[model samples]
Target: MYRYTDFDTAFVAERNRQFRQQVRRRISGALTEDEFKPLRLMNGLYLQLHAYMLRVAIPYGTLNSAQMDQLALLAETWDKGYGHFTTRQNIQYNWPKLGDVPDMLDALAEVGLHAIQTSGNTIRNVTADHFAGGAADEIADPRPVAELLRQWSTDHPEFQFLPRKFKIAVTGSANDRAVIKAHDIGIQVVERDGQIGYRVLVGGGLGRTPMIGKELADFVPQADLLPYVEAVVSVWNLLGRRDNKYKARIKITVHEHGLDEIRALVESRFAETRAAFGGHDVALFEEIAAQFAPPAFRNAPTEVYDAAYATDPVFRAWADTNLSAHRIDGYAIAQISLKAHGETPGDASADQMRVMADIARRYGHDELRISHEQNVVLPHVHKSDLPAIHKILKANGLATANIGRISDIIACPGMDYCALATARSIPIAQEIATRFDELKIENDIGELKIKISGCINACGHHHVGHIGILGLDRAGVENYQITLGGDATETAALGERTGPGFSADDIVPAIERIVEAYLEHRSGREESFLETYRRLGMAPFKLALYGEETAKKARAA
Candidate 1:
């Protein structure tokens, strides 16, 4: 984890001071609601349907025990008893009083966390693979580059207000766990010849218009990554639409203008961006990279882990689902599920946060991670410590063995909290999880991702789920639409919609029908839901969902 330097600390402190004054002015009636809107948004505060929401950045999803403890404190003190972890690997407090936000900001600043650029039309949090340093297949840790980008972008004079909000995700592994292809700017760390460089992608987004990123630069040397990224953003910043907010995204810009033209513009801009940095940014990157050096790992016997796995069925299930391969011999990366069967997808109670912090301190290498899938990760847990960690998590209601399963859904804070939402995403996600759990077939069904969004904004990343659910207001009633075969992995693809929208009452049954269809037609359990969907196409699923009559009628038409 990157520790905040004196300058970083001082900058955050100053920002907090300024925001404190801004909050006071709004409370004192010196600033009206309209006047306070942009100011509050710049600080990552949103006026939701019910209350004010505060989003705090977790840089590259890495944090220590102290930082996790601070998050728990914010949840316990300023907001509700729980915090919602988002797809961007950030956390949102849905019920914060307007006046207490500055205090919350100050508390976050103490832990080197802030909410800047989280909501505005600027470069949002620079995200990376949650298992960056720990993944077995990584070429290099992407967090150093992510941190460099974060430092460069935060409060940068040139990019504070772009035509639309931008996002960037980086991954060092060949497997795309970070969903980099769906970001405004996606960076993949690749080995070329003998050197590590970046493979840059641009124009990927997942709102009303979902797109997989195209290669902006096939290979950019590490030394030139910062300037090259700036060039791409700089080109889009000027070329992107400003008239209608709907078409303001860089995705739309790329759609309107050909990639060749965009490349030319970026190349022209890169010359200037490259020169301005000189060599200071590279030095800064090297400094930031050093801060992210892998923690000291221990060589330990895995007999305890093996023994526990053989003896305890509960531990076995959790371990099988939650653990990932770590780069170190004796270490494993463990994901703590926030999506318990009937609970909100990403909400973690303050006590749960503290429990995770304690486990990270005592078992993990004093480092904890928040996954983009809305789970906490102990990225460097030794195998011998698995049982004890599992026991503690089990006691705290964080030991759900449903990672990548149907019940382990990714849902946004929809109508329940978000003012922009049309229908309730939480209840839909809850119903689906509970129904699948009761059936007890989710484990047997194999890996599946079910993402739900309340609206077309795709906050839940429904566009990339194996079974994607999009909730909308049909006329005056709540309706849900289903999409099939979407993937967020290396072979990224947007889901295809299945005919008409279903009523809220019909959505769960529709999902069940699709799952049944997948089970019936799959080559074997070896083939996942996504594989079945892609292999058989939408025909079988559609027949199962809408029945033979509608399917035949549609096909004939």
Candidate 2:
């Protein structure tokens, strides 16, 4: 993990001091809500339905034990007992008072973490693969470049306050675990002619108008990475729409003006931007890369892990679902599931956080990562430590044996916390999870992604889910719409809506119908829901959800 430099430390301290003053002004009525809105947003504070929510960034989802302990302390002392990890690899405190936000910011700064740029139209948190350094199939760790991008974008004068919020994600692996295709700018680390570089994709997003980004550059040399990125965002900053808030995103801009024109404009701007860099950015990247050098691996035996798997079915199930192949032999990437059955997805209690921190300190090389899917990751855990870690996680209610399964849902706060939401999303997610658990066939169903969003903002990443659910306010009633065949991997695609929507009460049953239909239509158990959906389009699923008569009537009409 990269330690904060003196400059980084001082910068955060100063920002906290300024925010403290701003918070005091707001509380004292010197600044009205309107006046304080942008100021607070810049520091990652939002006025939710009932309280002020603070979003703290976990850059590229990386953290150390000390930082995790601080976060746990913040959750225990200032706000509620738990914090919600978000799809952006950020954490949210849902009940912080206006007066306490400054103190919270200061507390975060103490641990070399901050809420800066977690919100606002400025470039948001630079996310990467959760298993950046530990994944077995990575080209190279993407965190160094991600950190470089973070340094370049944070408070950049020319790019601050763009038309709307921007997001960038990088993935070093070919598997695309970072959901790169759903970000404003997606960079995949690749090698061309034995030279490592980036394959840039622009205009990808999932809000009101969902789009899989177009390839901006097939391969941008690592030397020109920062300048090329700047050029792309700069072009979008100027060309993106400001007349309509809904149409202001770079995705919309790219949609309106074809990729060719956008590419041409970016190329034109790249010439000047690249010239001004003078190789300094590349030097800076080299410096950052040094900070992210891989941790020393232990030559631990995996005999214990094998024994545990053989004897304990519970540990075996969890290992089967939550563990991934690590780069180093005898090591495993352990995904701590926050989505424990019926609980609110991605929420970790203060005690649970502390337990995870302790486990990380003892067994996980003092490193932790937050996945974009909202799970905590111990990226480098020795296989010998599996049983002990699983025991602790189980005791803490953090062991859910469901990582990419149907029950491991990704859900936004929805109307319960978000003011922008039209309907309740959390309850819907809970209901579906509980229903699936009762069915007891989640493992049988295989790897399924069930993502739920309250509205069209797609904060839950519903657009790219294998089985996406979008909750809406339909004539004062909570309606849920389902989409199928959407994927977030390297071959990403936006899910297609399956006919009419269902009411909240009927949504779970509707989903069951779809699942049952998939089972019936699939070639075999080997074919997953997504694969079946892709092979046999939405017709079968629609027929299942709406009955044959309704499907026929709709088709006939």
Candidate 3:
């Protein structure tokens, strides 16, 4: 909810002007594609398979009605009629023409949004918990620190060109909705003896080398937060690999050099960096925190919500799945499901965006959030407004009633749009979702996360899904690999891979076999898939995937 300051306004305007000129140069052939590539990337314009894609950052995934309306405009005017919400809490326009990117950037700037640092090997967008201030369990809101980090890293001279792109996420709650463990730098807001500080984690990432972050600092005081983070990034910037693009991430740096050594270096750097700040950042954080104060709560009766739950099956199902507890009594956080049955996961048409924006304005305190799970969040909807909101959401095709369920899949725009992808991810996700819908037993399955990535980049966060599916190219055919027992929560762990990859045609049936095994093996509905996997291990799931005969043969051998 932080508004752009005069400096922010002028800075974005100037950046847009520079990018406009760059676009003109590229179109006029003054700059070749090779020469223009970096420039366009810095502006969040990517040369995708068919056209240029523009990724617009929704910092900490916070947006107002006006901003959402502007995004809908962009979707309608420039690109295709829909926009894809990504795992990074950004929106991607897949069909923007190269010539029209400047105008798009200017449009975004008008709404106090930008594409700066959304791409390139610099610090990318700073993300936080989608339910930051509204979550009932939060110790303190993490967005103030997230905003501070954003301001610090945006165009920071020393970090403008790192060996690899850097990512940072923050969360105020213990539930870990932000997937902090899988980020380059993860900050958890913690209160120790009446003082709010941060529990910092470093070296956590997915992709080729998946790792759960190690604790960098158990407790960094609020005053020392910025400097401490800078020291960590500075050390990685100095030590991270530059020779191999694949291994250039900070996670690799931490993997090679022990955490103890990295901590020592960061501490040594922090001493100097801390002294230089001289409490300026502390004052700045206080100002930023003031901007994120919770909105006024309405004292309303929940009788309508209770009555609807009691009478309407459709509304009850949706309420059961999509609603989360809010910090304010009599209020709830409504998650708008982008993964509606067979639709492309995380995609919202222009009309859908407008509907969500309108709902937020009318009932959700004029605040909206884009969850890392690729869904829109009306973070502070009153319980009394549940029925009305649900009605509108149903009309807009945004009410899927599948939050945290089997069909609420997270998928990247794989070979369909990404040039780096070896196999398609969206179609696979669509097929699985459709199959699950046909089975009509998703509710019985319970709290399952199916994440898919086209390649090892792990953009879909497959590494931490309850059922992780990674798609790869095997001799010109798409082969999908499955991993089980992955959990992205306070107790974070990477999933173990199941033996042998399945062909694209067989992947859904393989998943069905695993689910059926879970249904048979579970201790009633009380035991979830993840819990069953944890207690029973991957043996049963493996047996289901490869058949009991194969398991017996392997045991005999």
Candidate 4:
């Protein structure tokens, strides 16, 4: 929700001008594909299999109604009439032309949004908790800090070309909804002896080498956050591997060089950088905070809300599933589900965006949010507005009543779209969600997370799901690998891989077996699937998935 200042606006305008010229050169054949690649990548454009993909940054997944309208306009005008929201809280358009991207960028700039740093091997978008400002349990809103880092890192000459892409996530709540530990740098806002500070974690990531980062600093005063962050990045920038892309992420660096050594190096750099610290940007933070101020709440019609809840079963189901905790008493966070059974996980049509925008203005507090899980949140909707909002949402195919259920999956654009992918992920996710819903097992089994990635890039946060599915190509055939017991909450842990990969035909049945095993092995309904998995280990799951004969043969061996 941070508004662009005059300076910010000017900078974006200038960047667009340069990119327009670059696009002209490419179209005119003055620049070759090789020459145009990095230039377009800098502006968040990628050449996909069928067309060019443009990833637009939605800073920390926060957007106003106007911004949502602009995204809808871009989708209608530029490429397809829809956009794909990603795990990093950004949106991607899969069908932008090479020449029309600059115009799209200009449209985004008009709304104080741009595609800058959405991709490339440089510092990407700084993400935080989607419910940053609205969470009732938050110590402070993390968006201002995210906004600060965004401005600091945007086109920073020193970090534009780092050894590998960097990601930073911040959360102000005790619950780690942002999956901070799976980021290159994770900052948690905490209180120490009555003073506000940050708990910093570095070198955590979820690619081939998934790791839960170790705490680097217990509590760093807020005033020193930027300088200390600079120190950490400077150390990594100087020492991180540049030759091998696979070994260049901070996670790899921390694995090779011990955490103690990296901590020491960061401390040394911090000592030097802290000495030269000019002053704190208190005024800037205040300015940013003002932009995100809470919307004015109106008195609600309590009787109307009670009557709707009492009368409408469909509205009741939606309220039970799609509504989230809000900071305000009379208000709630209404989630617009993109995971509507068999559709692509994050794809939203232009008309859906428009509907959401209208709902936000009419019922919500004029604030819209994009969850990391690829859903939209009307952050401050009054209880009395639930029926009307739900009606419009239902008309637009947005009322799914599945927020954290098995159907609500996070999937990356896999082999179908991504050039780097080895197999398809979206179809697999769709199949699984649809199967579970059809079987009527989603609610019966309770809360479960199933994340799928097309490859080992882990863009879907597969490594952190309760049930992680990784798709791979084996001799030109698609195969799926399952990992269980992963979590992304405060007690974050990477899932341990199960035995052998399953064929495409066998994957869904295997998942069903695993779920059935959890139910059979659980102590009671109170114990969830993960708790049962942790208690019994993978042995039962192996038997359930592959048959007891196979399990017995492996055990005998």
TM-score for predicted model 1 compared with the true structure: 0.99
Question: On residues 321-428, what C-alpha lDDT tens digit does candidate 2 reach at each position?
Answer: 999999999999999999887899999989999999999999998999999998999999999999999999998898899999998899999999999999888998
Give the CA lDDT, 0 to 100, for residue 257 in model 1.
Answer: 99
- How many Å off is the CA of 216 in candidate 3? 0.7
Deviation in angstroms for 59 in model 3? 0.3
lDDT (10s digit) by residue, model 4, range 1-557: 67788999999999999999999999999999999998998999999888999999998888888999999999999977999999999999999988889899999998999999898878899888888778878999999899988988899899989998999999999999899999999999999889989999998999888999889999998888888999999999998999998899998888899999999999999988777666555557667778877778887666777898899899998888888888888778788999999999999999999999999888877788888888888878888888888889899899999888888999999999999898899999999988998898777787789999999999988999999999999999999999999998889999988878988888998999999898899999878888888888888888987888877875675
Q: RMSD to the native, candidate 1?
A: 0.9
Clashing pairs in 4: none
- For residue 164, give model 1's deviation from the true position in Å: 0.7
Reference-based TM-score of each model:
0.99, 0.99, 0.99, 0.98
In model 3, state the lDDT of residue 75.
Answer: 96
- Write down the lDDT that model 4 would get: 0.89
